[model samples]
Target: MSNTIDREKRLHNRTSFLSNIARQLGRTQPLTQVERPALRHTCQNEVMATFSQDQLKDELVRYTETSLGAKAVVTTKADLEATLKQLCLDYCKDQQGNAAAGETIVSATAALLEMVSPQSLETDEHKVHVWDAAAGFDANIKIAERAKVGIVLAEEALAESGTMVLYSQANQGRAVSLLPEASIFVVAKSNLKPRLTQATALLHQKASQGERIPSCVNFISGPSSTADIELIKVVGVHGPVFATYVVIDDM
Candidate 1:
């Protein structure tokens, strides 16, 4: 009993000393209760809340073209490959304003490889370099920085904002969608949501299912642009100058 008392005394003395040191350093005991600010109520727009799927898609396409200055194309799954190929050829022009021969194209969407073969894009003079993001980290970075065009797959698209969601992972790095001169997204018609709220709910559901969530989720509305300099809007300031969405209906 005496030995136990001694140990308790020593422990108490040490704790007291530590507490004093903490106090000298301007640290105090933690508060039992912390005051938390109340969350502000958010107002929901009725039009976005009640929009039909078809209406939402139309709005998405319209906004993408007019407001965001992004090209949006609707095509059947069968025609996706051909349409995408043509778009690439048209967008990836050379310095002389002609269709370049040796332009590099990077793709985060693995499914696109089979749709538009890399070999098909390559020519004797151009030597088109098509890289799959899944290749490796080094390769992804190299391709992203140098590629004239980058293609990715959209997990979800918000019709109200004309934004497409891209979750970054090993197979889909953020650079593949951001670092290129032109960015293209392949979105399925069924993946289109009316508003950001719906998309957020879906993301929350996925999180609740113990699924692997990516480190970054990008909501790309259009090409990277800003009006900060002299209030003159400039596109491709921070990322791709051009953005395109290819919505596959049959997919």
Candidate 2:
């Protein structure tokens, strides 16, 4: 086995290094868990504080369509399944006019499954794969890679930026969104927030209550794009090329 010294031992002057920093900062010793300052100037919370939930959703729809170049649709809980199926079919349409040419993979969240069971979405013409944790990583990822559209339930939707907040868990993995050609994010109106400020507040509250925070949090807005190559804008260079957000107003 190769030998590589531990970082702690390699930089053994840890205490003295901190003490010097503390002295430079006019403190006798390094402050231990000092309370954060309460006063701060920020307009994040006040940006859309006056908008109603419907207004916020409208703003998200407009912003996503115009600025982010993504499709956004508002639907009711009763018609969610039909909306989802039609959207998946459109995305999976083949050159020969077949609607069921590609697979659709969905997250295994209980909320999503309750709304539209994957079994109901499946037909003789098409297949729908759920993020099955019991099948292990290899099996689930293989399906995701081949799937044309990935559907996931967002924990929260940010109105200002048209962003969908996703928290990774054992049942919901990031691969469902990253691997597919297109992604469909389903979010409820009640869970929609004004912006990132509210989303961060919820996470902070969870931390204060000593609840387990998610290890991976993703904020996705529209499709993957980058202008790094020759300063020319390009889409789908990093991940899925198409993105759509389906908002359930009644729920």
Candidate 3:
């Protein structure tokens, strides 16, 4: 009898709470549909808008190098493969003192995978273990956890903030970029934008065109870092400790 009474009291309280909320909202029935206004920007920076494509790219490189503390390199399509290999050899290393043999994770972007050329990554002297992001989520997570380097392709790069916009998709999992010790993003010159606003606008336009928007969009300005503990400034606390951007000039 007591248990039944307690349950009834709880239900009464919940109904009363909901009734009070509805009363305050001045509506007897829940709203079924609501209209939202379009987004508008009243204040626009003319200077940023007026910059040429070359100027925007230059600013992006400068800010990426100085402000973000990430290596930014400009290469042509022909030299991209060689440049990527050199970067891996420079950064990825193993206990045997061989970088080419280091464990690496590469995103499954068609362009990126084509450039990766796993065969070229392995030489007679050293054979790097390269895993693709297309592997299942759990497998990719494990690979990323132990991988020395992670490679991804950026959809858009914002110059004003030196930010790379990464859309999480099947081919490019978020873990591939976040779980590794170091990350390298390949960005095409045509995808570089003058500001974050422009980049976001483009994404909205894509969505409006009925393109499937990614589950998540990550805007990475630099390597993961924090100064929370005694303000000592630690890097790679929650994500990649080192971030590098390779900008393809002729892409």
**Winning model by lDDT:** 2
Q: Pick the candidate with the highest TM-score.
A: 2
Residue 146 C-alpha lDDT in model 2 = 91
Model 2 lDDT per residue over 89-113, tens place = 8888887767656798999999998
**16-130: candidate 1 lDDT, tens digit per residue:** 6877887898989842334557657544434477676666778889999999999999988778767777777777677777877545464535766656665665545434455
In model 3, the clashing pairs are none
Error of 3 at 76 (Å): 0.7
Report the error of model 3 at residue 118, Å: 2.9
Candidate 3: regions farther than 4 A off: 1-41, 44-47, 94-100, 124-134, 229-232
Better of 1 and 3 by TM-score: 3
Candidate 2 worst ten-residue window by lDDT? 1-10
lDDT of 3 by residue, 74-149 (tens): 9988888788777777776665766445666777778777766756755554344445545556876887788777
How do these models rank on lDDT, best leading?
Answer: 2, 3, 1
lDDT of 3: 0.77
